[model samples]
Target: MRRVLTALLLTSLLPLIAQAQSYSHTPPGHTGLGGMIGNPSGLSLKVYGTDPASFTAYDFLLAYDLDRFFFFSLHGLYERPLPDSPLNYFLGPGALLGVREGSSHANEMVLGLSANLGINFFTERFEVFLQVTPRLHLIPETEGDIGGGIGLRYYFGSQ
Candidate 1:
């Protein structure tokens, strides 16, 4: 029975594996649109730009969170490409602004400083990423929270 199940699973996954192998890791350009799912997660949009001196891409992220209440953030990240690989790691600073509500409490505007880190996998015009971000709230109260998510984005330029 185990052998039968394993064979069936592999057979089903063959097409997906083949497709993944056919995709190239070269990025087409600098901008993309996508969405993320996880703690305090929502829509994610990212842009990549090159620094003239290092000729490496830096990442900027804008994301909106709609869990329990609505909130948004903007982040600037320095990205490092892993040598001889299509994966890159990024970390940086950001700011978060949002409003929170509770049945017994008044609506409060939340503000914080945030740190973000993530790894990205690139295939042609697409990226798959995983990220963890921590925020230190400094306004309307003081608190901290850590959140992470997985995301996918499609580049807007040529492949």
Candidate 2:
């Protein structure tokens, strides 16, 4: 079931991810601030290892949902542009910590690992991306989940 859903999602995004041409541009800035709306959705912060033409970055996300549970995740990502276009793809491993309400009015700490796969289309001042993440919960119990979303980010200071 999970695999089917993931395949369906990637299929839907493939058309969008593949359309880019005629440009040779590097990523524009050192940091980006954005919001993602998805299975775990909220504020997103992206910071690069190098200011101008970074090939690596860190992604931080904080979200609240599932009847008010809080979630946090951090990803160390390797990002690279596609030779002559502003479109980039990234993949990485990440860790997640979440607080959720359990049965009997108790709260549980959820720990998980996630694999991120995504593509970004960069303009002069902003980036639009589509991402898919597969997550494995290892604490409280073992479970699996599929997560992703379409997001937009605005660069800071310089373009």
Candidate 3:
């Protein structure tokens, strides 16, 4: 009787185990649209990373800065996830472009190099993330700044 009951229980659990094995990670070929509020706060978008080709993901941010000027950044990130966890961390190189609030001889348009570092938590079709950006101003001036923000994204499409 015990052996028969054990066999039946195991058989019944097989489908659940199969479903768990078929789980997909966040993003990963999916696109996420979201917003962030920080130093330069506005729109955010991401082309989540894929596997077997490259571990790189593309992220974009378009926002207005504390100076009331429009700012945009793009990062090509290398992402990794914690073992058996829903948390992911990414780091990568980025480019920054911004327009000055007013026309000036110096840096009417600013260009720079920035680094993107962040952690993400995912649920069903949503992701919550936090990032810190360290930047180097290379055009119009030589300066450095650090910025960070927290954001939520909703992923769509097949992953």
Candidate 4:
């Protein structure tokens, strides 16, 4: 009698274990905060005769991938993303309010608006993404620019 009862209990538990393992393979809704390090490209003045120059800008972003197709990111970016594909992919519209200090420019507050788009890849807990943002600066000078970078994000939630 003892052996029969033990065997029945083991058989009942096996199905529950199998179901849990199957669910583990699917990804859950994830969001994260991360930082990125990349050079800023597409810094150009719109004036016909103005000379073109470039700056190395860094950015820190807070991102929420609402779903696979829709995402929202708030960036503390120094510059903007460029408009192009393949090489300069990931462009979206965004805004920035920060201070700038360069070799020739004084320490001043900057207000900028930008647009961007990008791609994202994810595992259960790790996420990698790349994006580009085209921006227009309102302070110091009114100009058009582009910036692109890659980032890594770690998800936090029930896995």
- List clash counts for every candidate, in order: 0, 0, 0, 18
Model 2 misplacement above 4 A: 1-29, 51-55, 65-68, 83-85
Q: In angstroms, how far off is 81's CA in candidate 1? A: 1.5
The local distance difference test score of model 4 is: 0.43
Q: Tell me the tens digit of each residue's lDDT in model 4 across 60-158.
A: 443222111112223332222233321222233457665556456556655777765665444555444556676677877897766555555565666
Taken over the whole model, the C-alpha lDDT of each candidate is 0.68, 0.75, 0.76, 0.43
lDDT tens digits, residues 120-155, model 3?
766666666778999897877898988877777788
RMSD of 3: 13.9
Q: What lDDT is reached at residue 60 by model 1?
A: 43
Q: What's the true lDDT of residue 13 in model 4?
A: 44
Query: Tens digit of lDDT per residue, candidate 1, span 1-159?
Result: 533653575466445444663332334236878877666557777766555444234444445444455677878776767776656787888888887875666787888999889877666677777789999988888988887777777888776
- TM-score, predicted candidate 2 vs. hidden true structure: 0.76
Backbone clash pairs for candidate 1 read: none
Q: What is the lDDT of residue 88 in candidate 4?
A: 21
Error of 3 at 21 (Å): 15
Worst 10 residues of 2 by lDDT: 20-29
TM-score computed on alpha carbons, candidate 4: 0.49
